[model samples]
Target chain A: NAGVTQTPKFRILKIGQSMTLQCTQDMNHNYMYWYRQDPGMGLKLIYYSVGAGITDKGEVPNGYNVSRSTTEDFPLRLELAAPSQTSVYFCASRGTGPNTGELFFGEGSRLTVL
Target chain B: AQSVAQPEDQVNVAEGNPLTVKCTYSVSGNPYLFWYVQYPNRGLQFLLKYITGDNLVKGSYGFEAEFNKSQTSFHLKKPSALVSDSALYFCAVRGGGSQGNLIFGKGTKLSVKP
Candidate 1:
């Protein structure tokens, strides 16, 4: 299986630009998450979904939106990108087990905002 | 709230030497802790996790972590370090709620020199 897959391995966006980071998982996991990794900072959760048609805001949800249209897909949207949003975006998935199961992450998409 | 802490910003070690990356966590109920590693320009990979039993959890890449409930710590350790082990390590705690959200630490960079 492909596990967790993310698109746009690299991208450059100008201030006020908009884009979407697509994430798809073949693991059929019930939980999906979007995280941004800054240099020394580990990662901050941007958004998450428990299952299809369900979504929730994470620690750093500003300027970002997410929708879980299907169990396999959860895309993150940047309405008005800024320089602060320039970081590596990682998508992860986990099975529906309480207090169990580790997250599986994608290769990550590096975004540079100028 | 569930939270994780990697006390060290970075850990340095020479090849064949023992290495340790410190991690501690806090949560209301039982804490489900996890360790992840991120290579250069790559996503975070699951190293190991502690759910219930087994204070010592072995994971990929000959890495292991010791879970100490008394100290609320889950530190990653390796008997012998390798240059290839250089990477960023993260500690996370699963939110005790049913949603199973994750809270991550700022991360610790492990550098192994030959």
Candidate 2:
């Protein structure tokens, strides 16, 4: 199985532009997350979905939106991208379990806002 | 709130030597901790996790972590470091059982030199 896959591995956007980072998982996991990593900083959660049609704000959700349209897809959208939003974005998924399961991550997408 | 800490920003070790990456966490309830690794421009890969039964959790690629509840730490260890093992390491934690959210620490960059 492909586990998790992310599209648009790299992108550069002009300030105020909008873009979507796509994520898909074949594992049929019920948990999906979006995170961004900055140099020397920990991964910050952007948004998350417990299942299809459910989404919630995470630690760092101010500039992004997320939608879980199906069990296999969780996409993050950046609206009016700003320079502060430039970072490496990662998508991850896990099975629904009592104990936290290991997260399977996509390769990641690097975005730069100019 | 659950949180994690990687006290070190970077660690340098010689090939074939034992290496340790320190991690500590705080949570209201029982803690479920995890370790992940990331190569340059890649997504985070699961290394190991501590759920309950055993204090020592073994995971992929000859990596292991010791869960010290008294100390509130879960440190990653490798018996013999390999140059290829060089990467960025992250420590994460979540409240046990039914808590789907995770808290991540600032990552530590590990460099193994031959």
Candidate 3:
């Protein structure tokens, strides 16, 4: 089973351009998240959704937006991308249980902004 | 605010040697800690988690982590390292009321050389 699927494994965008990173999970999880990984910064949360039709801003939400219109999909949108936004993006999902803190991640989407 | 720290930026070890990647966390309440590994150009994969019960949590690929609540550390350990185990390892934490959001460490690059 495809646990989590992400689109555009690699992409390049010019400054001020916009694009969307798509994420879908077959695990039927209630929680989904978008994170960006910089060279030495590990991962920073961009946005998250607890369930369908619900979304919230994460620690580093600037220049980005997210929507959760269904349980299986959560997409992150980049508006007027900047050089600082050029990083590897990952989407993750997790279920609610005793060990709910563990996250299953996608293969990642590498974006470069020039 | 909860946070995680992976003290070492890079760890190198010969194959068949025991390996340890140190991690420490700070949280106001009980902490749910996790370890994830990332291969080159890939996404983060859940390695293990420490929620409660046993301080020693065993996980995939012969990797385990010891949770020391008193020291606020959750260090990942492997009895014998393999060349294939080389990757970036991340430590994460979720505190009370985090709503499943995790704070990740800066990550440690482990290279198990042959």
Per-model B-chain TM-score: 0.97, 0.95, 0.96
- TM-score of each prediction: 0.96, 0.96, 0.98
iRMS of every model, one decimal? 1.5, 1.4, 0.8
Compose the digit string of candidate 3's lDDT tens values, residues A4-113. Answer: 99999999999999999999999999999999999999899899899999999888999999999999999999999999999999999989977577889999999999
Candidate 3 ranges beyond 4 A from true positions: B95-98
Question: How does chain B of model 2 score on TM-score?
Answer: 0.95
Worst lDDT run of 10 residues, candidate 3 chain B, spans: B94-103
In candidate 3, position A53 carries an lDDT of 95
lDDT of 1 by residue, B1-114 (tens): 888889899999999999999999988988888899988888888889999888999999999999999998999999999999999999999876556667889999999999
The TM-score measured for candidate 2 stands at 0.96
Clashing pairs in 1: none
Error of 2 at A109 (Å): 0.7
Question: Which sections of candidate 2 miss by over 4 Å?
Answer: A98-100, B95-99
Q: In model 2 chain B, which range of ten residues has the least summed lDDT?
A: B94-103
Model 3 C-alpha lDDT per residue in residues B11-107, reported as the tens digit of each score: 9999999999999999988888999999999999999988889999999999999999889999999999999999999999984564588889999
Model 2, DockQ value?
Answer: 0.74
> What is residue B24's positional error in candidate 3, in angstroms?
0.6
TM-score of the first chain alone, every candidate:
0.96, 0.96, 0.98
